[model samples]
Structures are given as C-alpha cells and as structure tokens.
Target: TQLLEQSPQFLSIQEGENLTVYCNSSSVFSSLQWYRQEPGEGPVLLVTVVTGGEVKKLKRLTFQFGDARKDSSLHITAAQPGDTGLYLCAGDKSGGSNYKLTFGKGTLLTVNP
Candidate 1:
C-alpha cells in the first residue's frame, strides 16, 4: 500500500454545503500537517496535529489526527467559492532521513458560488 493516501482525490460542492476529506497511511508518523493552496500560490499551513486523537478547529474548518498518528482528516463545515483549493496532508517523521514529510497526492476541492 502507498505510505500515505487521500480519498476522493477530487470534490465539488455547492456553496453552503459540507464535505470531509480523509488521509490515511500505513506507517505511523511523529506529526502531521495540513495545508491549503489557492491557484498559483504555495500552500499555507492550516494546522498541525501531533498528538493522538487530537482535534483542532479553525473558523469553518476542523482537523483531526488519528489515535495512532498514522492518519488524519479535514472537515469543512460550510463550503464557499473561496474554499476552492488544493488540500494536502503531510506526515512528518522528524529524525534522520525521516525528517522529510511525505504528502498525499492531494485532494482538489471546488466549491461553486
């Protein structure tokens, strides 16, 4: 299996709708970071969850880290055109060559206004 993966790959929703994107991995990670990117721009860190079963909320978005620290999820309470962007989940190993993060291919979310 791929070390890390994201479901749906793509999601399209109308404004005011809700959606959840999932990230999974077979190997455990020391930490995980979620990032969002708009067109032509680099991804901006939304949050980082390092503890098992930890949850973090930001405005309309919520992020959760798996109890095993091997997976995570992002939930958008209400969709908006401004929410359209690329969502990425990255696992941080933080030691030796493992310090580099392994990213999920990415989830492309489009919210129609």
Candidate 2:
C-alpha cells in the first residue's frame, strides 16, 4: 500500500506570518496534488505537480515536488486569517486509475488575526 506522511499535524500562526508544511512518502507517485478545505465544505484543489523538481506558485502559496517524486512541500507566504483550514496532500500511484488517490493525514492550520 502507498502511504503519505505529512509533518506538523497542526499549526497556529498569527496573520501575516509564514509557514511551510511537508508531505513525504517512500513510494514514487505518478502525480501529486494539494488541497485546502474549509469547515462544512469539501477540499478544494490548489495545485498539481507531475514532474520531478517542479515548482508552482499561486499568489501567496508555493508548492514544490521532490526530485525523486517521493515528496512535496507547501509554503505559505504572509498567511491571512482566511487561510485557516485543513491542508491535504494526495498522491496517485503510477499504475492506478485516474480516480485512485491516496491522501495524507492532513495538516490543520489556524491563522489567527
């Protein structure tokens, strides 16, 4: 079975602060995706990384894929109170169907105002 480990299961930071969360695994994946979820709502996909060493940025958020495709990282620059939510990282096994995704335990972040 494929498994993903996310670091710092929980985090609390004041608004405007910055933080970085990590996701790692022993197995290489064909693709990886990041998502953010708010209470009472499903997770919203943030970005997807397929190529090794790929880096993607979305406004204040940045994502990086490991060179070996076994890990990923997310960096939030100047977090806002609105950014408080559950962050998730999911990986797709190399040979699995497109819908088959293995999700990490998730990291809960609270950005206090």
Candidate 3:
C-alpha cells in the first residue's frame, strides 16, 4: 500500500476566504488525481495530472503537481459554502496497463458563509 498523507486533515474557513490543501507521498506516481466528495455521494473527479510539474486550474481552484510527482497541492482563491466537502488525492502506483490508484485519507473542508 502506498503511503499518501494529506495535511491538516481538516479545514474550516469562512466564505470568501482562501485556503490550500496538500498531498504528499514517498512513492513516486505515474499520475495523480484530485477528487471532491459530498456527504452520501461518491467523489467527483476535479482534475488529473499525468505529467510531472503540471498545473491545472478550475475556476477559483488551482492544482499543482510536484516535479517529482511525489506531491501535490490544491488552492482555492475564495472559499464558498458550496465548496465544503472532502478533498481526496489519489496516486496511480501502477501506470499504464496495470493501473492501480492509491488514495489518501482525505481532507475535510468546511466553508461557512
């Protein structure tokens, strides 16, 4: 099992505030994926970084993958109540044909208006 750790584990912020969450692992991955999940719902894929040192942005959210592909981070420009949910980082340990995804425990974010 891959050891992926997400910092803070939990985050609580007011609406319009900015925040960032991080994911790190000792094992190098072929690709990384970020997902957000709401209560009683499956995680929704937000972004995927297949190349090292890649950066992706979705609206007010920014995602960055480390050059070594061992770490990643997500930053939100302005927190919103609608953005409150569980953020998960997944790493594809086995690339290509044998794709295996290892997931982090996740970071719980609560944005209050």
Question: What TM-score goes with each of the models?
Answer: 0.94, 0.95, 0.96
**What's the candidate order when arranged by decreasing lDDT?**
2, 3, 1
Winning model by lDDT: 2
Off by over 4 Å in 2: none
Per-residue C-alpha lDDT of model 1 across residues 1-113, encoded as one tens digit per residue: 56889988999999999999999988898899999999999999999898999999999999999999989999999888999999999998763466578889899999998
Q: Against the true structure, candidate 3 has what lDDT?
A: 0.94
**lDDT of all the models against the reference?**
0.92, 0.95, 0.94
lDDT of 2 at 23: 98
Candidates' RMSD to native: 1.6, 1.4, 1.1
Q: lDDT, candidate 3, residue 49?
A: 94
Residue-level lDDT of model 2, residues 1-113, one tens digit each, is 53999988999999999999999999999899999999999999999999999999999999999999999999999999999999999999955567779999899999999
Clash pairs, model 1 backbone:
none
Q: Model 3, range 1-113, lDDT digits (tens) per residue? A: 64899987999999999999999999999999999999999999999998899999999999999999999999999888999999999999888866568899999999998
Candidate 3 residue-pair clash tally: 0
